[model samples]
Target: MNTLDLHAEEFRQQGFTVFRSVLPPDQVKLMRNLAEGRYRACVADPPDRDTLRGGVSLMRAFEFGTAFRDVLALEPVIQVVEALLGDDCHVISQNVLRTPTGRGIVNWHIDDALFFPFFADLNIDPKHVPVYSLNVMIALSDVPTDAFGPTQVAPGSHLSGRRPERSPDLPAGWEPVSLRAQTGDCYLVNSQTWHRGAQNETGRTRYVLTTAYGRRFISQRFYPFINYTMPPHVLSGAGSRIERLLGAHDKGPYG
Candidate 1:
């Protein structure tokens, strides 16, 4: 079988998969430059402590640069997302996450809690519900060691049907796996997977771009329809794929 088939199978079994060098050098350079500039700016004029996540994250990156919008529409990344979430998927959030040396750990948890308000009344088991969301993470810098604060995931934990407990007190039989990859690599992660960002102990910084995608039926996590609008330039030049990913074509009947 081919790489796509392998990745699909891996995702089905492990809740995540990695594709190495999916982003070309030029694209990597562009994202890296944008992230570096933004990181410096955030350091100079920091946001509120709660919004900053202890000085480790930057949200809504697609609003900051056209390059990030392009990253969201990359064919390889979309192919995997579509394989897992179907063609009706659209991006829900885009963020650039940076872990500086000595930054503390991000506790292990699942990403589905935010959606609880929408799905709580269904009264269905999570494992039975089709996975409607996934995170596509692009590595902007090498994360080949634990010191760089690589993300740690518990394999096959999504099958548990509930969020895994904290790292040091995981349920019986589960184990954390440190995800190590080089620049330009991308990981497709199921939002249900139990994962956390390790502390950055090395002097080097760890940079990652994360784009979260979900079925069109799911409400966006970051941007609300009542007040948010896409930039005019983005609306004009974006292709159909970008348009769908941006939720331009998923309007309700009343709107």
Candidate 2:
């Protein structure tokens, strides 16, 4: 198997894996500028700031700029995501996180409600674990140390099938791993994995472009749940892969 396949297997077994130098330094700068600009705009516009959770971020940020939209299609990141969740995987959510000095997603928690919860006494095969969704984090800034507040994941936590909050106990032989990366690195994570951003004290902002992918059976979370339309300009010259990533889907099972 090649490096990406190994990385995919690592993602399956360890709950996450990082791909180094996925984007060029210049491209990282461009995306970082776009993200910071979006954050600043959100700050001025009270409505946009509402997406800011424990960390500074904007949900569905790809809708605003082509640079952000381009991020969703970066091949290195998609390779691992598609390998784990299948090629039919499409974007479930695309958001950006920017944490400056003294601020980060300090709370350790799962991304959402447990997707495949099981009992402590249940015997399960690690290979049988299903991946329903994915989290691909594209780091536009360097996260070389704990002080930079890189993401931390419990190795194999997804298979534990227990929320860190409720269980708080590691499955035997599991340990926490801090996902530190250089600028332009991309990391693939199972959404079920227990994770959180470590505190940032580097006096510089940590910029991460986050994209979530789900299997064909899962629905795209474009929000509003009613009549949200993808802005035409964003898809002005996109190809088939980007369109699919942007929620363009052919008929699938149970449709």
Candidate 3:
């Protein structure tokens, strides 16, 4: 069977699916280098809004002007997301996530529920969202169980419709599962699934880029703000789909 069908079936049953080595090694290396460089630059001088109260969102990241976008636009990932969401899918937010060693763990939460609060506010059922939200996590390093804390997910938690209560143990063999992935592997998860970034016990920090996708009708975060002074490619197509998804009509030059 095609990978997209495989992923959809897995997600339907398990609430999560891992695509091993979806990204080629060369592309993964380039993206990882680009992400690190962007991270360093953001650290040295951050935009006013990016200023953090504590640990820099632990997930603060950049999207525009990187080879990473090529990966985001990959046909395999797109097909999988489209299968899960629908035909008219748009890119949501693509951001970097970092877990520093010795730091505390991030809270367990669902992506769609946290970002799109209006679903609950408007009293709209999540089942009717057109395109179901899906989070595509591309691993940037080897995350093992003992050393690097990747992510802990409660399998089948999306169906629960609420955050699963955390505990040291569960009734059956069903406990929070830690996702340990290699550099080029990718994990596709239901946006409503319960999960969190586990603590990084390794001597260094862990990095991953999270690209979110949703049906075209739903709004999106992280609209691209391409710099005008940059090259034509950067400024022309800035925020095309993002603007539409966010329900705005501010078209860019390319748009």
Candidate 4:
């Protein structure tokens, strides 16, 4: 099988898969620059120190600039997403998540809790694959060690159809795996998978750009109606596929 086929199969069985160095180094550098610049600008203002200390999450990033939108249209990345979600898949949310030094741990949880019921109702088996939605996590900075708080995931836990218990004793067969990636790597994760952001003890900030996508029928996680509007230049320059992915073609209630 080809690399795409292998990734699809791995995603079905493991609930997540990583594509190493999927984004160009230059593109990754650009994203890192944008995120760092925005964070610095935000920190300069009078916002409390608490805001500056933790993860800096910027939502509706695609609307912030063309570079953010450009990442959404990256051909190779989109191809893997399309392989799993089909050609009609559309982005539900886009954001840049930056974990600053000494940021506390992000507790383990599923991306969308609503999906648990759907999985249970359907009696989806561990081996039975479903593609409701996914989050494309693009690493904009090197995450070389635990101190950087790389993403920790419990493989195959998405099949549990619920969040893993907080107790020390986990469900049988569940084991947490910390994902390590160089700048520009991307990980495609099933929205229902049990995962968390580890504590950042590193002195430097870790940057990640996340874009969530789902089949066109799935309701968006954020306000699609107001967030979809982009600058006239951006809108005019976007292809039809990019427009649909950006929620322009969404007719769902939230859209």
Candidate 5:
């Protein structure tokens, strides 16, 4: 069987899987340069402190850049999310990470909590809230196994049903596994999985782009940066209907 078939099975069992060369190396490099240029330009101006809050606006508007729309069109990443989430699944949240060399690590955490905030008070069934169906992280640069930390995750943690609390040390049963890869590698993780960004001490910028998709019935948080002034071509292949649903500029019934 092909990689997609293998990845699909792995996702079902482990709740996540990594695909090597999901995007062509040349394309990944081009997109990375385009995105980095936009980020640098934005940072050249006074920084917006709120942008660091780990919100959708911060990730999509500032980091992903217009070229990211092209990346979203990649067959492997798109097909995997669509296969897992069903055809109507839209881009709920797109992210870009620009970790400067030698950055400190972030706390271990779960991605779904950002959407399903009431986990602590789920007087009702937790299933009612939209948990992330799939989370895709695409590496735009090489993440060496030895340096410039990549994402660390606990394999099969999605089955736990309970989110792990923050701790300086790993709990007794959990093992920290790093998701390292070269440019064009993509990691598809279930929203239920536990993961975190490892620190980058290698003196090189670590860049990655990501998108979270949910079933069609769910709402999209933030997408299609309001500051994006480019024309349709920038997001052309994303399809008008899908773009409207996934993007913020639309004013139709979904809007």
Candidate 6:
């Protein structure tokens, strides 16, 4: 099977998959530098508006640098995202997640909202997975070991048709899998999957460029919901794909 098919299969059954070496070393370094700069700035002068996910996220990060927008339409990753969410998919959320040492999202939870609570009592077909939102995690910093605190996810937990439990235990033999990634590695997760950031045990900090995509109907969340438009400078030389990912859409319900 082709690589896209493989990713589709993995995603359908496991709720998440990692694509190693999806980015180059130089690209990774550039993104990491951008995140570091933003984090430092946030620390220096807090923004007037509240930050998402507490203060760890550099909100709407893609708007800050070229590399961020460039990575959004990456051919390989886009192909997989489109194949799963359909060709009309658009970016719903994009931000840089930076976790400092001795800090991380230790709780397991789903993204956006629940998808299957009403169907929780029924049997879910393994062959068919209903995916709404997808999170593309680009590793800007090396997460070479558990100490570095890779993203932890429970395989197939998304098919549970319910929210993650208040306790740590999962159904059957399911256990959290640490995605020990390296700089430039990219991993995709179904937004409904049970996931959390393993605590950063090492002194090194963690940086991840997160881009969330959704079906055409899913609302775009570029923050400030109203009166937010893509900066003309950012789209000065961008191609059609980039434009679409940045919220360009042909006539829809509104029209």
TM-score of each: 0.85, 0.90, 0.75, 0.84, 0.77, 0.93
Could you tell me how far off, in angstroms, the CA of residue 223 lies in candidate 4 after the best superposition?
Answer: 5.0
Task: Note the Cα lDDT for every prediction shown.
Answer: 0.77, 0.80, 0.64, 0.77, 0.66, 0.84
Best-fitting candidate, measured by TM-score?
6
Give the backbone clash total of model 1. Answer: 0
For model 1, what is the C-alpha lDDT against the true structure? 0.77
Query: What lDDT is reached at residue 114 by model 2?
Result: 86
Report the Cα lDDT for residue 194, model 3: 76
Model 5: pairs clashing at backbone N, Cα or C within 3 Å: 102-200
Q: State residue 138's C-alpha deviation in candidate 4, in Å.
A: 0.8
Per-candidate count of clashing residue pairs (backbone under 3 Å): 0, 0, 0, 0, 1, 0
RMSD of each: 4.1, 2.5, 5.9, 3.7, 5.1, 1.9
lDDT of candidate 5 at residue 201, scale 0 to 100: 79
Looking at candidate 6, the ten consecutive residues that score lowest on lDDT are 45-54
Evaluated at residue 66, the lDDT of candidate 5 is: 46
Return the top candidate by lDDT: 6
Runs with alpha carbons beyond 4 Å of true place in candidate 1: 43-54, 114-129, 167-169, 223-226, 250-255
Total clashing pairs in model 5: 1
How would you encode candidate 4's per-residue C-alpha lDDT over 154-197 as one tens digit per residue?
Answer: 88778765776654335686788888889988998898888888
Instruction: Please identify which of the two predictions, 3 or 5, would achieve the higher TM-score against the true structure.
Output: 5
TM-score of decoy 2: 0.90
> Distance (Å) between predicted and true CA of 125, model 2?
2.8
lDDT of 1 by residue, 42-108 (tens): 7777552222444667776776678888788787767878877888789988888887887745678
For candidate 5, report its TM-score: 0.77
Which wins on TM-score, candidate 2 or candidate 5?
2
lDDT of 2 by residue, 45-119 (tens): 887765555447678877767877887878766777777778887898888888888887766578767887764
Sort by TM-score, top down from the best: 6, 2, 1, 4, 5, 3
